[model samples]
Target: MSQLITEVQPDVEIYIQSIYQTVVQRNPHEVEFHQAVSEFLESMAPVIKKHPEYQKYAILERIVEPERLISFRVPWVDDQGKVQVNRGFRVQFNSTLGPYKGGLRFHKSVNASIIKFLGFEQTFKNALTGQPIGGGKGGSDFDPKGKSDLEIMRFCQSFMTELYKYMGSDVDVPAGDIGVGGREIGFLFGQYKRIRSGNEPGVLTGKGIGYGGSLGRTEATGYGCIYFLQEMLASQGLELAGRQTVVSGSGNVSIFAIQKAQELGAHVVACSDSSGYIFDPNGIQLETVKQIKLVEAGRISDYTLHHPEASYYEGSTNIWNVDCEIALPCATQNELNEVAARQLIDNGVIAIAEGANMPTTLEAVHILLANNILFAPGKAANAGGVAVSALEMAQNSMRLSWSFDEVDGRLKKIMQHIYQDSIEAAEDYGFEGNLVAGSNIAGFKKVAEAMIAQGIV
Candidate 1:
């Protein structure tokens, strides 16, 4: 709540006040969620200044409060014949453009606040893709890690039992995020099919390819991020060739970002997991990292077993201190802070693209913007995964399968268009070349216009 932000968005001030009240009442302890919302709202200052009409719909208030919130109790039997109960939630945040679409995360940290924030971000991310999909996210706090296959299946079935009632092919379609992968999707889809007694293949995305998943859905996010960076650099007459890049997170997005970076002639020097980061000055071999992460499903420390040149750091925040031209944070929210931002700036890092949701803090984003670093927010840059997921839904409905090249071509075009829109938005706001401002303004305008036309629904 700075004077500058208020001055830029006087009308949005009411919406921000509403968000604060809602956060205080419902989720006082959700500091991270508040941080994400505050940061996003602050970034929308330029949009509010340019389009005062957006304030009529109270976009921030609607953005904070989901259109629909569904919570259900899931009862399932464990392996030891003990009954276990978990809560499942699906926040159908918005559907202004089309059907509700997003991922269903099954992690220990899944909560109403987390899902709400994710869903809010997904709404704009979906709109930025220029696709006919809205925003919704569902998940449970049921941790699937180390659970027996039967146990996981039981949990998914019970969760889907309630979820199936609210989902359909042309309604809310969920995909995989942190923990809800192929196995979880398979279980959820099976239960949905059984419960509904119909063969609605488009009810969910990220299904097994054998069922209805797209060919490049798995690698779309990471590859899409790199593709965005590629376009950003190409606009400046540069490329990834021979540049050093540091990527945080060894998950699906980061792993493929590393691979695609290598494919584009960039040398990936660092990667990390939740435990810590592994730094290899000699450049991390994609095959080695893939075998250690994908095949073995091991931690980043296991990477040193094959590549003795790499070193592991157990706890550190300044991953950008390693020095590189490109920094892609494929990790969780606010992983990159002002300290990391300053380090990146000092280390001569030229560009940053978030592969995770709101990976950079507000201060970090401002620092990057002040330094003129080419930065792309997660909502715009990482919309590829969900975009392809939507494509998967389209293919499923058509009973058609596209080749790898065809799907990949569409993904690349979508990402490029997003980048172009972001650039145009920045220029329109008089912050030309600032992708941070560009992305926020571009996405906010789309959602705001839809909300206004729909008359506060």
Candidate 2:
């Protein structure tokens, strides 16, 4: 795909491309990390042109590289007593804003590249949240699916044994992501406490409520996505009420996004899992979905057993084929590509907000922007998860828990401010109405300014 810096001055374009090429050469085979850095550096063209100090101070060079990368072995015994080994990683991308913060995924797809990409994106996402958290990500290539409770517990214990050495309330704070959730968090936190001999709840987020978890952390990312969508629609004198929407993914983020969009009067007709997607023209029954996915822990195809009227398809990404006014890609990175973007556009998609990190490819993003569709990048739209994580850190420090309503209200306000900040930043940099550039610039400027203020580290 062509880079977004093409339209800028030749010198600026050359500078941006040089940085990107350097990133590629230094981090060979890390396609995901390369993609993230390319997208970020492309947005830096206007910034570098307007503020040459960033170049003078070598901010671009420093920001693209992670401060630390920790790789360790995680060996655990399965239920059958056979030993297994999985590689784990923690990419501390940046700490200029504050301590490193991000989630720990436990999917088989996880590797150094995936962790670095997530950490790089988390840095900007945390910055946009107006929180003190820095950017980091960690996970293992350990597939949590089909693992028994004891097996998972053993794995968590083994993983945290190595990871706990680097974690602290004032240092790195890891949360749940992908295959990691409340149950996994409980096991990991238990292991951390056992090893460290301290009750530092702030060391992690997404804990069970009876423990030290925040009330609305589970719904923050999904609900925050809709809140951002609400603000984006309102900018054009539009309302979410009565809009037809399709949200991909059936995980925590997707489920809550569907719930909030429905609450606001939008008809969310479709959601998906890795196996396939389910479309309910009568509007998805959130309770049934929760029961099947969360309680029963079954496949999304089973959603049709409860509601025969709905149709289930075998392809997950094909969910975009369903016609809708709004599209929320809440699934993993690059779930929606150029074809999906064009499909949504052909079907009259007026707006899109990413609920997952870089869910849409750069090509898809360009296609959406060229068509004048309202696009909210994941960094700005899905910052809610990390934002609430920051809040949970505060709550843990104060030894107080906020009510669900209180946390939700705060999440809404933070999302609003992020949207507004993106708008103002975009306009200030002569990229008015282009939220992709706006969000990148807004987030980049915040971290870059901090990096400059603190001097070379």
Scored by lDDT, model 1 comes in at 0.85
**Per-residue lDDT of 300 in model 2:** 96
Q: How many times do residue backbones clash in model 2?
A: 0
For model 2, the stretches where C-alpha displacement exceeds 4 angstroms are 1-3
Cα RMSD (angstroms) for every candidate in the order listed: 2.2, 1.0
lDDT of 1 by residue, 146-184 (tens): 798899999998998889888988889999998887888
Clashing pairs in 2: none
- Point to the candidate with the largest lDDT: 2
lDDT of 2 by residue, 1-457 (tens): 3445545688877787888899899999999999888777767887998899999999999999999999999999999889999999999999999999999999999999999999999999999999999999999999989999899999999999999999999999999999999999999999999998889999999999899999999999999999999999999999999988999999999999999999999999999999999999899999999999999889999999999999999999999999999999999999999998999999999999999999998888888998999999999999999999999999999999999999999999999999999999988887789888889999999999999999999
How much lDDT does candidate 2 score?
Answer: 0.93
Per-model TM-score, in order, reads 0.94, 0.99
